[model samples]
Target: MYACIAQWIPPLERPRFIAVVLYAIGLGTAVALPMCGMVIDAAGWPAAFYVTGICSLLWCVLWFSIIYSTPAQHPRISREELQYIENAVRSSGTSHNGPTRVPWKSMATSLPFWAITVTEMCNSYGITIIRAQLPTFMKNIFGLSIKMVIT
Candidate 1:
């Protein structure tokens, strides 16, 4: 998303747009996590999955409606805004002549890719462990009810 923002927004606006996007992600997680917990308590874990899945589909619909290959291709972008973005991108020398082909083999062997993969694997392990065990741990050890654990 940060990468996408760099493509779609002008340089001066990128940081602000990225901050807004990050804030939105945090806010949505704060709200939706508890909502998922409540849904799980009321219906089941599967119900929580259903709710999130539907939300993902709706978000995809919104994304597909608004997104385009470039600022000029976007249906709702103003001429000034489009020109600003294009000029900024061009000035920065990041504008591509055409679709760049992925260097899949080189990427597979890259140190940065391995570093990111390892970091993500570690992060995912920690998050998954907390998600799977925290409620049970609180219920058993701290005597917290599902509602208390959620909130």
Candidate 2:
């Protein structure tokens, strides 16, 4: 989904688009973390899970209704916007015949690929630790309730 969005972004705006998408993701996580804690504290852990599940379902529905893999496929887009996107893609020389086959052998030996893999693993580990343990840490170390930690 993100790769599709990246493809649609004009080359000059790609950096800003990626930054904004990442910022939104981080912001959503920040907001949802405390909200989940509060929900768990108030209604119990099951309710928090239910809330999250419902939100996910709603997002899927909205995404299906609103997003297209390409600007040319978007039914609700204005003619001007469609023309702009077509022009941008044409000018960028990024239009493809179809999906290209991956160079599996090259990727397997790539230093940059290994670097990114390791970096992602470390990042996920840190985020998981904080997300899974922060509430307990706050309770034990700071003598704070779940609601208090969230607040």
RMSD of 1: 2.8
The per-prediction CA RMSD against the true structure, in angstroms, equals 2.8, 1.6
- Which residue pairs show backbone clashes in model 1? none
TM-score of 2: 0.90
RMSD in Å for candidate 2, one decimal?
A: 1.6
Tens digit of per-residue lDDT, candidate 2, span 80-139: 988887788779887665689999999999999999999999999998898778778988
Give the C-alpha lDDT of model 2.
0.85
lDDT by residue for model 1 (1-151), tens: 6556657777777778888987896688667777877988999889999999999999999989988877877888889888889999888776777778999999999999999999999987986787667668888999987777687
Task: List the candidate 1 regions with Cα displacement exceeding 4 Å.
Answer: 103-113
Best by lDDT: 2
TM-scores for candidates 1 onward, in order: 0.76, 0.90
Best by TM-score: 2
Clashing pairs in 2: none
Deviation in Å, model 1, residue 116 alpha carbon: 3.7
